[model samples]
Target chain A: MRIFTAVVAIAAGILILGGYFFPAFEGMQALLLNWAVILAGAAALVGIFNLVSVHTDKIRRQEKGSVYSALLLISLVATFLFAMILRPNHATMKIVLSGIIIPVEASLMGLLTISLLYAAVRLLRRRADLTSIIFLVTAALLILGSATLPFGNMPVLGTFVGPWITQVLALGGARGILIGVALGTLTTGLRVLFGADRPYGGN
Target chain B: MIELTIILVSAALLFGITLWKRKSPANLREIPALTRLHRTLGLSIEDGTRLHISLGTGSLLDARGGSALAGLAMLRHIAERTSVSDKPSVASAGDPTLGLLTQDTLQAGYQAAGVEELYVPTSGRVTGLSPFGYAAGAMNISQNENVSANIIIGHFGPEAALLTEASDRDNVTMIGASDELSGQSVLFASTQDSLIGEELFATGAYLGAGASHVASLTVQDILRWLVILALLGGAAVKLVGMI
Candidate 1:
């Protein structure tokens, strides 16, 4: 099994790299990549089946915390059916996505505010470190600078100072995050390409 | 043909270097947590510390393939270890696709271990469509289930803190790794072992569950070196131009 997997992986990588370097073989390579993507898409059904089967059993057994399972199943099945059967146009789909799914997702995201605040408070309880101090201080300033309103009515210190502090940290933090993300992506991509990491099938 | 030849040549060169290596260190397989994953799982089975795995809400496509792959690798490792030990494990997934892959991995691992009946779909539960709901559901499992060790890996967002907080509160020995820094920060604050960036990519290899993941790490290191050189060279050129 291991040998077979290794052989297939080597072949696939060769094909993929071949497609990248050889413009003449682009069509075949592109087709292979497309198939790889399509295969992944097909594999998604495995996930859907797992979701349905698990939730259905929970609903049947009426287990503890099964209500959430039920809700998840209903939402999933409803969305799938709505999309498949209704055949909603792009505009309508957008409305459903934005109005229902987005709001729920966003509100859930908003719930993170409480979690982050809680996490922040927990950090404050810990032994002081430079990283923690920096994190806490930046978080506090960011929160205060943004939430504190009526800057125009306040003194120059309130208006200019708050905005400047927030903007500088926000921009720098954003850049750092971008760099970290890019490096992470590059590393992950290389891993996949080199057959260093195979998540598809297990040992 | 040319590209394939180049790749083969480079791989051969690397293979030769590894074979003919001047001794840098005695140990090549010296990752602490990754080594611990297999060891801990085997030990926990006898001790009865149920494995808790949470796959975050970000879909494979949402987090761009890598997160999904990482999550799957983790699933395979836990599944195999637990199956071998005849221990129970819970896999709670935020995304539907992840839930499915995890389920399959669990079942297959059990089957491989010749305990196919123990492989339950409920083991890989799809908790919620949204983040909070998923977090809440996953936390409920950690609280209610006999889970001894909590392992959270994937594309967790803000709700990651909530889940980690609950895991910490439960006094569960946890290993949390995420591609997102915010999630990583939250996990690092709360959990014992938290992998950041490319380290997350090494989880599979380190666990000895996925050789490809190890190979991937090697490739990642090479890419990093290339990127560093490119950046340094570009900066040097720019400096020269300014001069």
Candidate 2:
């Protein structure tokens, strides 16, 4: 069974890749891709069920955050039912997305900024390496450069330093990281295709 | 034609190296994060505290699936280490499809260890589909579940900071890795030991998954050097043209 699954996966992968390069296999690729999508959707439903079951278990056991679990269940069920009944683009759906979800996410973003600043401050305390010092200095300069001065933009800090640091140094580093990730992804995909790493389960 | 040649060459090198390493296993360079992972797993079992592994918001059907699979491989190693312990490692994923895969990996690990009965469906969970929502769920687990160690190796964005911060608050031993650049930056600062760039993909190899993983890492290193040389050559050519 494992061998059969691995063979199917490799064949599907090859077909998908072939479809990208060859016009003849496009239909087959689409069919396989659609099947994968349907499977993903079904898996998502199962995940939702798993979430409900876990929370229900917590609620039943009256764990520390049982009330939170109950609240989460109520919210999930209510939102799911509303989506089914009113459809996704309804005013209520819009309100839920804009009013609740967006705000919460925005707040998390705000928290992230503060947390980053806090991490910067503690970098020295944690590691105290030359790298940490350089990171802190760079961060401090970037923050100062980006901050609005009382007499308007400081040309040296804001215009020259900020742009050079952000557009040149940071961008270069990010690009390097991206290149490495791409190579890693390619290697991982190859491993999967060759049946060496069976993430789809069997091995 | 060039792309296909490169792909075929890489595949050949990867397979050839893998077969060679099966006879004589290649020694991998030390990854401090992986070393810390070994200690963290031992600590979790000794302390009877849970180890939370977040697979991030990578879906199985998308580009992020590669990272998600890498994360799953790490989870399998973790599960094997904790299979006999009362506090087995728990995994969470942002995508439902990946979460299902995580459960399978967890079960496979336990079964390999001859402890299949200990596998629980709830051990692997889908926290949230959205990035922040997933981060929030993972943070809650890290904070409330007596998680002694938190290892996040998956595809994440800037939201990873939230998860790292949660672990920080509790003084949990945190090792963060991600394929996303923004996530790499965030985790580099926040995580005590961060796996940057391709190091995230090398976790399984570093943890002794198999010769194939090691071979893949060797191929990655060779490719990286080639990329560096190409960059330099291109720069030189551009400089000569300008002159």
Q: Score the docking of each candidate (DockQ).
A: 0.33, 0.77
Worst 10 residues of 1 chain B by lDDT: B18-27
lDDT of 2 at A117: 82
**Measured by C-alpha RMSD in angstroms, how accurate is candidate 1?**
5.0
Q: Please write out the lDDT profile of model 2 over residues A1-203, one tens digit for every residue.
A: 88888999999988997787779999999999999999999998999998999889889988778788899999999999999999999999999999999999999999999998888777778888887787888888888888887987777888899899999999998899888888888888899889888876647
TM-score of predicted structure 2: 0.96
Query: What 10-residue stretch in candidate 2 chain B is worst by lDDT?
Result: B1-10
Model 2, residue pairs in steric clash: none
TM-score of 1: 0.74
The CA lDDT at A162 in model 2 is 83
Clash-forming residue pairs, model 1: A47-B100, A191-B216, A196-B212, A196-B213, A196-B215, A196-B216, A197-B212, A197-B213, B50-B148
lDDT of 1 at A187: 46
Model 1 stretches with alpha carbons more than 4 Å out:
A1-10, A36-41, A71-100, A126-128, A145-147, A152-197, B1-43, B57-63, B85-87, B92-100, B111-117, B125-137, B168-171, B188-193, B208-230
